[model samples]
Target: MRAHGDFSRTADRTPGMTVLTVDLVHHPAHSVLTLHGELDFASSDRVPPLIDAVVKAGRRRLVVDTVGLTFCDSRGLRALIHAERALAALGGGMELVNVHGRLLRLLDITGLTGVLAITTGPGAGQAVRK
Candidate 1:
């Protein structure tokens, strides 16, 4: 179903550019987190709990759609790592889909690309709807 419940701020940080927002889309078997704006220091901290909630609610998979993510830093990486670890411990896991090239490079540099499941199927970002 289509839902617009944001877990973070939606106010524009700049004139026309929003700084960050974390929205949730609940699916039957999974949860889709649509992240917009920068997933840096100010925003990264808000991620892990959401991931935990999905797993806690008995969802086996969580997909982080970063296509709308404009920027991410080490803290963002840490957040993803934390979520991954938590899910693994719970016998569940996460998918980082539609990740951009630059972000992929960051994960590669940090040796996280190997630990996390990344998917880039055709129109993966559009997967949020179905």
Candidate 2:
């Protein structure tokens, strides 16, 4: 996963402060990319490269796991929309998992709840192991 506009490095150059941790993960299944992160301005820029890489990798379906995300801003929401559009252009699709709290509310308020497929809780759509 590529991290763009990471303030962690800039913070290091300054001083005094300790450190802020931003974690991101990309789980590519058959044709999906599951993401877990804060999804704020600090990490929003990272979404594009991930999408690009996935497209280049020839994946069609994208599933984003938002279960671990604690927060998200408008920019972050836009990133998801942009990803969906990009995938659509390639005749692919995207889905979101573990939507809850502020993230769910944001989607509702922005009228995206109906536009995106959102699964909730731990067992919303778990895959069975063989």
State TM-scores per candidate. 0.80, 0.73
lDDT digits (tens) for residues 1-130 of candidate 2: 4332332344433354322233333345424444444566656777777788777766766777666577788988999999898988888878787788889999999999888878876675352110
Please report how far candidate 1 places residue 62 from its true position, in Å.
0.4
- Across 35-101, the per-residue lDDT of candidate 1 in tens digits comes to 8787877677788778766866678778889888878888888888888888788787888999877
Local distance difference test, candidate 1: 0.77
Output the number of the TM-score-best candidate: 1
Residue 4 miss distance in model 1 (angstroms) = 4.7
Worst lDDT run of 10 residues, candidate 2, spans 17-26
The candidate scoring highest on lDDT is 1
Instruction: State, as a TM-score between 0 and 1, how close model 1 is to the true structure.
Output: 0.80
